[model samples]
Target: MLASHEHYRAAVAQLNSYAHAYYVLDDPIASDEEYDILYHELKAYEHAHPDHIAPDSPTQRVGGSVLESFEKHTHLQRMWSLDDVFDIAELEEWVARIHKSYPNAHFTCSPKFDGASLNLCYENGVLVSAATRGDGIIGEEVLHNAKTIASIPLTIPHKSTIEIRGEVVIPKEDFARLNAARTKQNLPLFANPRNAAAGSLRQLDSSITAERRLLFVPWGLGFVREALSQSFYESMRAIERFGFYAPKILEAQSTQEIHAYYEQIQQERENFSMMLDGMVVMVDDFALQERLGWTIKSPRFACAYKFPAVEKITKILSITNQVGRTGVITPVAELEPVEIEGATISRASLYNYTDIEKKDIRIGDCVIIIRSGDVIPKIIKPIESRRDGSQTPIAPPTHCPECGCALVQEEVILRCCNLSCKARIVESIIYFASKRALNIDGLGEKIITQLYEEGKIASIIDLYALSVEDLLELEGFKDKKAANLITAIAATKHIALWRFINALGITHIGEWASKELDRRFGLACFAKSYEEIIGIVGFGQEMAESFVEFSAVNHELISRLLALIEPLPTGSAVGSNMDSAMDSSGGDFASSAKRPLENLTFVITGTLSVPRDDMRERLENLGARVSGSVSKKTDYVLCGSDAGSKEQKARELGVKIITELDLEKLIGF
Candidate 1:
């Protein structure tokens, strides 16, 4: 037993040293195979003597507990974002502003990792908790998941309380491997490493997070009980000594040096193990940073210089028409295969015929395709100089590609008026089973297409009628798979009213609008007239008219669908028959004395501490209407940090501006 105890201690010490060498110093004394063999021996010993295992042991990273939901935690110090500078001139202006305050200021520039921001709090040299940057002040505690990251040390060398701010990212190689595994399991692929890292780090299951292999790179310090140095660069180096992956820093004394560093980082961005969106330049002196302080949303001491968007030239092989669930026909350009930012691209959206004509995009023409941030890849413009006489002009199709019906043009959009268009039907069914709608697991696009092609399912209603026996006949379905699919379909019979409304594929009605409609009218939304819908504060004339037309044409179909599914109450409306109550009250919705803020219209703008969508929902639940823009009729504007032109326009129109604190007071929260 004494020998076992000594061996355990030695293993833990060796593993911690190896981790520091590999993660912090980027140098290793032992090969990966030797490390793995030693790690397994330590894990086996720990498993046999669980009570004897140390808290800081490397084997203790994967916690056994699963969280139901993340709890809100108030940050000890505010985590301010950095102001962005898009061009060199803006960066120069930022430098000049900083120099005006500190004439001898020097800066430290480092890559701004493109991933989820995390705050790690350590007490007495041991990590106690980790939280996400939820609202700068309040964050979600994700300690269980955060402990799984190999780069985050469970115990540091410094025996003091400290808070480290950094980014949690999935390395590019791990991200690709994860996506490949997901593809094999028929799960949706993560769009990028940032998204994958964010999703993985926020998992409710700590085991899943541990499996994801996320890495943490500390870039800034939130607070330290014991000061290591007065300079930020020296403090970062001190942090590195405590076993953290501190970002590589470059010192710049002038704007030219800063620009040169930025260019060098941008050129070498693809070579990094993780994704980087930009570079952050901060004044190196802590005293100067304190003097500079902060603006409303970001720090005045530091600024981010974003790299130019990734663009690649590819030839458009052909243009094809894709019909949406609403029967709107969109033009898609099939491009020659090209790789950009670690992703392979073979297609880009042409939007509509109007966009094609405006850009003069043609087949066989070399076009500039760009992927900016999270936006979809799009064609910037056709390289007219490279276009030869062999290039052909793309013409809009006069007939629907799926149903051979006449196509109708509505302003800039083209649509197939045929309700029975196969493409439209397939798309609607796909959407009905989507995560936002009925949430029927195992009903993916391939299966839906197969069912449609085999004439087994015709509409959304047909999904409820599927049985295990019917699914067994499909190509990929074994007995267990068939039963599971049937069970999944059955589980979706009771769905949220907003999801049901959105699943119907009503023109101009999205998930948010559906929720609003369900809130104001409830089950009686089916009986609302065009004028009554238009009377709603947020509903536009076009949306109202579209709803009325759809209801008039498909009343029986809608009634049949509603009978097959039960809508869960939203709790947003006081009664289930709000339309009947309005009718009885002579269509005067203002007569309801129970409704607070009933007649008020609000416009929300800028970055709120809380999510904007959450704030909007809270307001709507209190019987207030939220609009997308500021207008003369707007009663108030809920302004947050960096409130832009909307706040200015509200002031000009005599609309009251309210802060987040004011909103809380008004809502009596």
Candidate 2:
């Protein structure tokens, strides 16, 4: 019995050491097989000699039963919140204040982990309790759930009663996987990783928390009976040696160093595995920290220099539908103007009626708007908890709000089929003058709107008839602006055929489709039958039917536009101008040597050597059809670093995958 107990004790220690190396140090000392064998052996011994089981044994991490409710736990040392500093000026002011008290004080800077604060109390080297930082003084006990975190040590070398405070975070990958699992089970998705980590830690069942794969990153101590080190940075290092995962800390003596580090972190934050809201700047010397003292709610010694918020909570004042150039109705949330990352976001796209229904977004509901650098502002989810009895459900409109035309359902979206709808006409004109369509430089949406509203232009055809005098009648239209606009309009009179087709704003036909249709029919698409359009490769029934219907309905308009403009056949080698557009690769597709990728379909994904659009253009110029998605029909998937779902789909379909170098070789470049 004694030998078995000794063996069990040895096995437990070995497994814990392996776990510390693998989870905390990110270096595995033992293979999975070795660890599993020992873990099971310890479990078996504990099963036979149940009374001999240690509280800190690896098996105890996930062996707890579900709790009915969380018990209140009072922290021995209060967990103080850090004062926030938004900009460098605010940080400087904060440092100046700190300098007044401790002039020689140096700081320890670490990532302000955007997660739930946890206070873990260890008595005699064994973790006895863990709790959430509810009100800083007292918190809800979550010891069982806390134990499930692999990075959190169940036992340490410190025998004194110590209260270590840390942030419990889920790595971005693990959070994604958790959300995916929840999606499979039809659960409400978490808004972000911080929410996911907080929710996981609060689970009634420890097993649920264990499944989340949470990480406990110790930032500082609440209280320690014995000091590890006099310096804060050295103390954190000592904690790391005692089996805790210490976050990377930078020692900064001056405010300039902190600002430089902040800038560096801002550039590299995206590369981090977890979300970092900002950096926590704390006095490195424990004596200085103590001397600086505390405020009513936070420590005077430490300040959180926060990055501009990527996610902000705002109230949805109303839900409105926006009409696109193609008359596709998109539900847009008119939000209470909130600033996110230095931009005032007053509107967010709900995408469609289906998305509105899926997300249960309602008028008067508080919603979370997510906007990262350059990404379009979007309503992620409505905060259902904040909903009151006054909030109303958003329903799809039966008729077009602009023209009062009956709306047509197309899959998940509603479309305004009326070609003469005022909104549709206005948007179409804007789209026609867009860079991709006509390459019209001075004609923007605002300019087009002004022209439409002032009765200067009604349709795409009317744009060509505009005079400088007509534009001068509207607001903000000077002589130079009007001339520029007229010149820009006149410039598109002799554009490529593809641009003309794209400018038409036909339903289901985008730039790529326009290019494909141009390649196949050139100037003869208007005369082509529905069956012929359908017979074209990659042209589905919807696109074919839309083209046929559009051609039939707008035959007069198209004929008049054709007479007004000289649309050169872009894909064919006709004039020097037309040849220049087709020979983008400095080679002729109509050459005796056939285009290598002719009739092949390629799907491009991830961060390629060049821009994605450039790569797609290159592939298209080589006579290969570049698709947005991957399927069995795809001949090859041109992939690069960090390829997402499309690459995975290609793998599943057994489509040939090639890198940028391989593509260069294949193209004989």
Candidate 3:
């Protein structure tokens, strides 16, 4: 019995070490399969000897208790915010103020994650309760929801009582997926990840929190019964050793070092999984921090050096209606050229006619433009304070700007309704020839516009009918360039099934949905019943209905395009080792389904020699599903230069990771 107890303790220690390495360090010391084996053994031993099982066991992380409602709890320590510094001069002043008290003070800088703050209390190395940072002293109890976070360890190595303060955030990739799911359900989408995280945590049901996939990252100590280290850096390292994620810390001894560190973090913020608004600079020495003390609201020992705001004030020159590929006329704001967050802004999307009327936006009004992350510049609101009486209210267009077709108002959007509208045809062809779709190189927007205006290309099918001689009639066409474009158009005659489906530009059907549809139904997707289409995982009733509606409206167009384009045989859809067997048999159709990647899901990250879209196409062509985020369901991750959090998450989840060269080997590229 003693030997069995010793073995159980050993298993728990081993599992804790693996969790610390995977979660805190972003590195894995053991394979997931190996860890699982050990974890199961531990569970079995505990099951056999329940009396000997410790409360701090890793198996106790997932709680089964459900709560009726959240209760209010008082915090043991007050949670304080840090003073903000917007520029280098302000940061220098802060450093000077701190140095006056502690002449030899050094600082530790870490990311100021934009997220909801939570305070977690641990007793006897076991997590007892959790609460939000409400009013600094009192907070709503959320222990039930807190247990759902996988990154928050339910048990730690510390035997003393301790309270940890950390931020809860949803990663950017996960946020997109959550929003997409919400859109399919016709629910209002959360504006950003921070909002999503906060809403998820405040849910009455713990299951809702689990589904949102929130992560908790420790930043500072709230209270501790026993001191572990004398320096802040050392204390953070100790916290990490207890299996909690701590942000990357950089030590700076001088103002120049601090400035360089802040700049480095700002440049790399986008690559981080969580949203970061600034860097938190704090005195590294515990004694110095204690001596410096705090003000009524903020601590004097720490200050936040924030990055320049992505939002800027810009003037709207005019509002123009742009006809999309789907014939929906979207209002776009043409802005006076202004720089925001390193990019020059000239145009911002105003969404639809309803958005303009609701915001009271008008031509010649000054507007607040925001360029957050990789998203396009968007007008948040008009600066009505600076508006003069000369501002003209934008009226909805009565006719199509390009072809003079009568506009039809459908719900919140205005549409051209005419299939033969020149702008609609041009945009459709351009999208069909885009890199993510057919990948027809040399066919750009300008060239497509010229071809449509000259009546040489009226539809997507007309591109296949064009010859070098037909293109030579245009003003700027040269023999070599025209031949290259024709050749490029011909090369796109054969495409993957998913790309062909996405190229159709059906409403609510994006590249990801197209891939899912192809994986579920393959070539027979168009013929599937609405029930069958909606039954597929990750697809909803709205998408299935949209697909049926689109097919009914454009059946003839689809048939004509199918006649011109040959969709290459997919491994799962066609049933067999189609690539190799068909090649050996001189393109003979096979009978048996043999998809090597039938159940595989891949995620691509970082820069590759070929565009990421092209790489995704190649993988999907072989019957694989590509997702944006890494989860347990992910089969593999294709990593390239500068791969960031996705790669790290893959390692933590024990998903197979491959390089671009490795991917080529798998697909026989």
Highest lDDT: which candidate? 2
* CA error at residue 448 for candidate 1, angstroms: 14
Q: Rank the candidates by TM-score, best first.
A: 1, 2, 3
Which regions of candidate 3 are displaced past 4 Å? 1-3, 28-48, 184-187, 312-366, 371-669
Please give the range of 10 consecutive residues that has the lowest summed lDDT in model 2: 571-580
Give the Cα-based TM-score of candidate 3 against the true structure. Answer: 0.49
What range of 10 consecutive residues in model 3 has the weakest lDDT sum? 582-591
Better of 1 and 3 by lDDT: 1
lDDT of 1 by residue, 521-554 (tens): 8778878999888987778877887777666655
Give the best candidate by TM-score.
Answer: 1
**Residues forming the 10-long window of minimal summed lDDT in candidate 1:** 576-585
lDDT of 1: 0.81
Tell me model 3's lDDT, rounded to 2 decimals.
0.79
- Tens digit of lDDT per residue, candidate 2, span 1-669? 225777778887888999888887778898999988878778778888899999779888873578857999999988988888889899989999888877888898998787899999999999999999997778999998998898888888899999988999888888778878989999998867778899999998888888777889999998889998899899898888888887889999899999999998888887877778888999998888888788656889998888874788999998788887678898888889987643468888888988888888889999888874323587888899997788999989998888887777777888876667777788777777776677687787767777788888777788878888998888878999889978877766667787799888888887667777877788899889999999888789888877876777677788889888878775444433433563456664433245678778999987887777767766776778878888899999998996767888888889999998998799787
Is 1 or 3 the stronger prediction by TM-score?
1
Q: How much lDDT does candidate 2 score?
A: 0.82
